[model samples]
Target: MRTLIVTEFISLDGVIDSPGGGSHPRAGWTFKDVPFVEEAYEIKGREQLEAGAMLIGRVSYDEFAPVWPSMDDFAEYNEMPKYVVSSTLSNPEWHNTHVLRSLDDVAKLKQGDGAPILVHGSATLAQGLAAAGLVDRYHLLVFPILLGDGKRLFGSGDPHTRLDLVECEAYSNGVIKQVFDVVR
Candidate 1:
């Protein structure tokens, strides 16, 4: 079986929205005068290269498709078998991209044995995956700041999903990387 890993950069208050310079009031919180951890790149680069595929939500696809394809540093993301989950996205122009129309499409993709399937910065998709019990692991990079008001990882109405922490590492910049296995 393939593993589905949801990776996110979240604030201490569980806010994962617009961490990458989005127009929110607390946007760009991930890189706003914080201590830089050099090792983070190495860790993330490893994961990016190790992942077999990229499964992103519509919102994230909109934000990323234009930028990621043009970047040279993100070669793994640029060349991977990209799956965008969106009912509205009828056409995807990015390289090696495929449009997934439903949750059933997502489930079908995970049926075969392969390297890990990675999902990044897709809160709605993450919630849906959690609700459907499709998330195998969560790799959360928690920043120390608290963005009091923004889109969060878990909404009040979302289903309760328990996770077991399998690994955790704290950086000098007050950023913590936590790896959790979704408990069945």
Candidate 2:
């Protein structure tokens, strides 16, 4: 079975909302805002690029479509085959993208012979996957700052999840990269 990985850049307080300063309520709470990147900070992103397919939530797709396709920094993100999990959106404007109508479809797609499926910026989707026991590994890049109020990775009334830490590292610029395997 292909591993499903959820990768996120979160604040110390577990806020994953608007790390890129979009129109969202909590905006610009990222290392990009302060403009700092240690050499060690670059590895996880490159590693995620190795995944064969990317599964993203609709909101993340909308936020990323304009900049990622046009930019050169995230070449892997632009080039990778992307499967978007969305209910309302009929058609995707981005190239090399497919829309998944339901969460059940994720399991069917995972049965294929392919590299790991990586998920990014899909808070709601991630929660659903966690509930469904679909996610295999979780890679969290914890930033230095903390936002008291914002979209959290674990919302209210979420079930307690048990995760076994695979590995963890601290970057010079205070970014922490933690890898965990969801325990059954």
Candidate 3:
């Protein structure tokens, strides 16, 4: 079976809502005004190229589509196969992008052939995938900030799922990168 990795740039408090100044209320909580280190960018660049396909939620898609397409830094992501999990959005203007209407569609995509499906910045979809027991791995990039009120990576309406830590690393800037495999 292919691996489905969910990658995230979250805060110390597990807030993954808007690490990139997204419209979400939790926006700018991660590194808010601070600039990222060169190592962080390098790591992200590597992850972007490593994934066979990328999956994202509607909110994330909206926030990213407009920018990534124009970003010279994320050329890999712009060219990769992208799957957007959206319920209401009918038309997506991104290249190599497809819309998944339901959880069933997501499962079907996961079953198909390709490189591992890497999910990024889609908390709602992540919750659903986690609850449905579809995720195979998680790559969490934990930043060094804390936000008391923000959308969490997991909790609230999500089902209980245990994760086994497969690997972990800590950067000098206090960025903790943890890779977890689903315990199913």
Best by lDDT: 1
Cα lDDT of model 1 by residue, 1-184, tens digit: 8999998988998999898776688778788746778875455787887999999999898899889888888898898899999998877999999999998899999998899999988888988888788899988888999888887777787777788999899888999999999888
TM-score for all models, in order of appearance? 0.95, 0.91, 0.91
Q: Which has the higher TM-score value, candidate number 1 or candidate number 2?
A: 1
Name the TM-score of candidate 1. Answer: 0.95
- List candidate 2 stretches off by more than 4 Å: 32-35
In terms of lDDT, the poorest run of 10 residues in model 1 is 33-42
User: Clashes in model 1: which pairs?
Assistant: none
Q: Residue by residue across 10-128, what tens digits does model 3's lDDT show?
A: 88888887787776675775565445666765557777778788899888888898899999888888898898988788778999999889989988888888778889887888888
lDDT of each: 0.87, 0.82, 0.82
53-82, model 2: which lDDT tens digit per residue?
A: 889889889888888898777777778788
Which parts of model 3 are misplaced by more than 4 Å? 24-26, 33-35
